[model samples]
Target chain A: MVMHYPNGQPYRTKQLSLKKSPYPTATLYGNRGMTLEEEINESNQYYLKQGIAVIHKKPIPIQIVNVDYPKRSAAVIKEAYFKQPSTTDYNGVYKGHYLDFEAKETKNLTAFPLANFHAHQIEHMKACQKQGGICFTILRFTSLKEVFLMPASLLFQYWDNQQANNGRKSIPYEIIKKQCAHITYQLQPKIPYLTYVDKLLEQIL
Target chain B: MVMHYPNGQPYRTKQLSLKKSPYPTATLYGNRGMTLEEEINESNQYYLKQGIAVIHKKPIPIQIVNVDYPKRSAAVIKEAYFKQPSTTDYNGVYKGHYLDFEAKETKNLTAFPLANFHAHQIEHMKACQKQGGICFTILRFTSLKEVFLMPASLLFQYWDNQQANNGRKSIPYEIIKKQCAHITYQLQPKIPYLTYVDKLLEQIL
Candidate 1:
């Protein structure tokens, strides 16, 4: 059976349903259920307030073709078109190390889909890694209520193998659990992903 | 006399008109007249291709209230409202330095207006500077056709002064020219602002 989103979009689901009554939603509507994007954004805010790390989500670029000057102070965008982003979603500095990452959520229970990532994002991550920055992807299995922070090195390895006609389209959940750190959620911080980041840094050190 | 933009927006001209249209009027909208944001974005692309930097403009967060899912692939944002950004516009890593800055353009001729910047942006820049990261502003005087790279330290000095009833709303053009390096436009690289960044680094070194 296919699980349908509140917006009526069909999604892949596991045998165990994680669906629960959605109450106390965000100010944003379709965001009735907390999205991985919102959770991470909130987590970044938490990090910033504590002076731990400074990361921010890049804005989606839109070409404002036409604008209406309704008043001198307020310029309303009348006609605009979205542009494809050329970089990862989140980036900043943490403990003198430049950090860059993209966060994605998939409903698939067995593996994370390759299609969830774009060609440019992989290329951008490769470029960041070359520059000696810590680059990674935070993958979330929404159906399983699990999140994993996978390094870009492993991601690039899998991505290159896929190009070589390898059968792996998605990373298996078991492999992720073994290779990546799982993050827990908190109240004010929401997604306490950075706690895992500290652990990852300790391992690297 | 007030100078009007090609799009009919009134601007305060800093100097007398030097030359009339030598080229045909049709060339005005061609490759020569890209917006400051577009130029910077293109320059970032150039930096990425060269494996030099990985800067990206932060997306303006929007509170998406409603969306129309006509197809499974296409989710159209129907009802949404803009949210205030919490950090600087542009951020990334360049030569092991964490770079963060905001690009702003104004029509004011006498000085760069302080009101163009927000409170959170100032606070964010201060935080980045405290961490020994490179933080600055790329200020473009559209009416004067001039751009300058002002360091966050100098910016914060003026920003703080404004709070103490300094009575200065804009930074004088002479001070900017004396203290900050000017950026020239180029074809493929667009803004070529990072050349000024090299000079800034030289001063620090």
Candidate 2:
């Protein structure tokens, strides 16, 4: 059954559920359409085609509430909601190293709010790190058109401080600029973050 | 709206859609209740808690059709269908090495059919292998209650030969037993395949 709104828009339209991402709303980061995640996705495909790396964004987990099975056609999920993932958005292998990271964009001028990440994500990164995976966060300051890769170890210090009620709720951009590598956007593999990965490989190896 | 059967069973029940997996029907392999996938999930959870590995089965991606908003509680996914994934079911880091594999079961006593896998999954495994990740498939023979971890390299050889129309469509049990490590079942981890992983690591490192 089709549901029509007072404005004549159908409730069953595709646009409704596509907007639901688990991240806290950052209305200040006004994306005209494409998100940082989209760019990384495109970049990952490029990397794949060039045989540079094999990273991928895992699909968002959903809790399905209802589905309808028709005789001939595919099954239809009629009711579902997104679930919080236990790990980060992207992970893969780079030069025999296990790579994992999360990407988030903000319009904040002075700081990248640590609130953008969840506790479970922190735990997951720590777990991966313990297993020898390189884990980090990719922070995009949209308004500034700047991206930075901050190691999970550094992020944890601040997160731990926040939990102890002894520090700022976010990491100031100045520290990020000082400590993290600035990721410049490229045309083919737009997020060429692996250039930073090359440097990371150098440090570890 | 509520739906009811002639016997008065409610349509909003969870039993309907939970049965859907993209694999071709293998009704001949009767499952008492818990499946091989569920067992691996349990084992993965056990590994995670013990800090032994950081592996996880990727969520089944769904192409949603319709959703309903009830004004209270979570959003309801009204219609959705399972989508084919390009990669294997599970991937993660194990002691600094990237791990990727798929789990499959068949009742066939003589052989494990290659038809159980898709071309895209093969492509994905090859791509991951190129990036220095370890790739393999976990095969279970239901009637024999036996499981084996066959490296993707071996699987690829058979797949390539089959595509060239020069090999058996399925891998014979003798070959699997001779070539792959047997996965022993245990109580705590249930499918303690990581024991096979430990052996593989010994061979490599």
Candidate 3:
């Protein structure tokens, strides 16, 4: 089903279909057609139930201007505007470590655009890192049908380079595949991203 | 303005008039009609702008079951339900300290109702305290026209008492005034609750 915004614009679901080949497909369930946000939200619920992590998507901040009060019981928001959020999408605690991250999907097969990220989000991640929290980004390459957990440190390098007039504003897909670890999905755990986190923790320790 | 929930119930706004008259009558304007939530939010923005702290109110969780897409840029949520939140309203950092709090207001002239809080919220606060974070509740008595920064440790005692069949489920206004520090508002820092935080930190240190 297609979703339209208030302005009647179609909302794009970042669901990529994997090519059926002799080799194992990198994308998980090409037919499910679930958006990245929905899948991640489900994964978070799974994580919460298993007593693993308690990450959650921050609600889209809206400036509520007017409301209609029909009765003493119910209040209906009559007018509101979406406000730009100053932080990343998800945050919570995992194994005594504060986890924060942003997930983005790109259709380009060769590179992932840096413009998908906001300056404030990058600054927030930097602050989180300074506070000894685990910060990262999940980048999904739709054309290649692959997803990788890229550390915020690596992301900052590209972000800083872009400010310094770097040749390209996107990180090449090859670099991500080689440097970052892949998160697999399981029945109970759903998003097995914590396994990669365990590895990152091991390296940090 | 009236805001209605999805269930067609009018959302109740906590009134903020005080009756005890501790300070001068002129100061009563500051105490009139401002919710504990609104005060704390303004305080947080003050803290953020000064680089003194970084705290934010978490978004209300909602479960969207269906959506209608009319265009590629917007997704109108057609069917959604509010989900129970598992954490406190506000959380972030202040001087390398993890700060967490829940803001509550009561209209009772004699006491602050314990029922204004939830079991899960108390549990979350306890958990954060166990992890060495500063957790507290900013309580406002609208009828009494007063606000108090009650620590989680003190709050837990009252919460525990309620479960033990204590007939009194509310904290007396006199007890709050004696035990917890009262917050005064400033021009820039509207809530000025962090002044109480400084005292708490001193005691902890």
lDDT per residue for candidate 1 within A102-158, as digits (tens), equals 888777889887766778889888877676677888878878998788888778877
> What is the C-alpha lDDT profile of model 1 across B1-205, one tens digit per residue?
3334433223322231223344432222211223676678779989988888888777655444443333323334443334467788788888777889988776678788787788888999887776667889888888999988898878888889988877687788888888887888778687887888888888875
Interface RMSD of each: 10.5, 7.3, 9.9
lDDT of 3 by residue, B1-205 (tens): 5554442233444452333444333223322323566667788878777766667887655444444433333324554434456687787766556677888777788888777777888877776665567789888787766778998887888889988877579888888888898877678787888788889989875
Candidate 3 similarity to native, TM-score: 0.73
Per model, how much of the real contact set is kept? 0.20, 0.58, 0.10
Give the lowest summed-lDDT range of ten residues in model 3 chain B. B25-34
Model 1's TM-score against the true structure: 0.76
What ordering of candidates by lDDT runs from best to worst? 2, 1, 3
DockQ of structure 1: 0.22
For lDDT, the strongest prediction is 2
Fnat measured on candidate 3: 0.10
Q: Which ten residues in a row have the lowest lDDT in candidate 1 chain B?
A: B25-34
Q: For each candidate, what's the DockQ? A: 0.22, 0.43, 0.19
Worst 10 contiguous positions by lDDT, candidate 3 chain A: A24-33
Candidate scoring better on TM-score of 1 and 3: 1
Q: Candidate 3, overall lDDT?
A: 0.68
Q: After superposing candidate 3, which stretches have Cα over 4 Å from the reference?
A: A1-34, A130-132, A143-145, A198-205, B1-34, B60-86, B127-133, B143-145, B164-167, B192-205
Residue B2 of model 1, lDDT score: 35
- The better-scoring model by lDDT among 2 and 3 is 2
Q: Which candidate is the best by TM-score?
A: 2
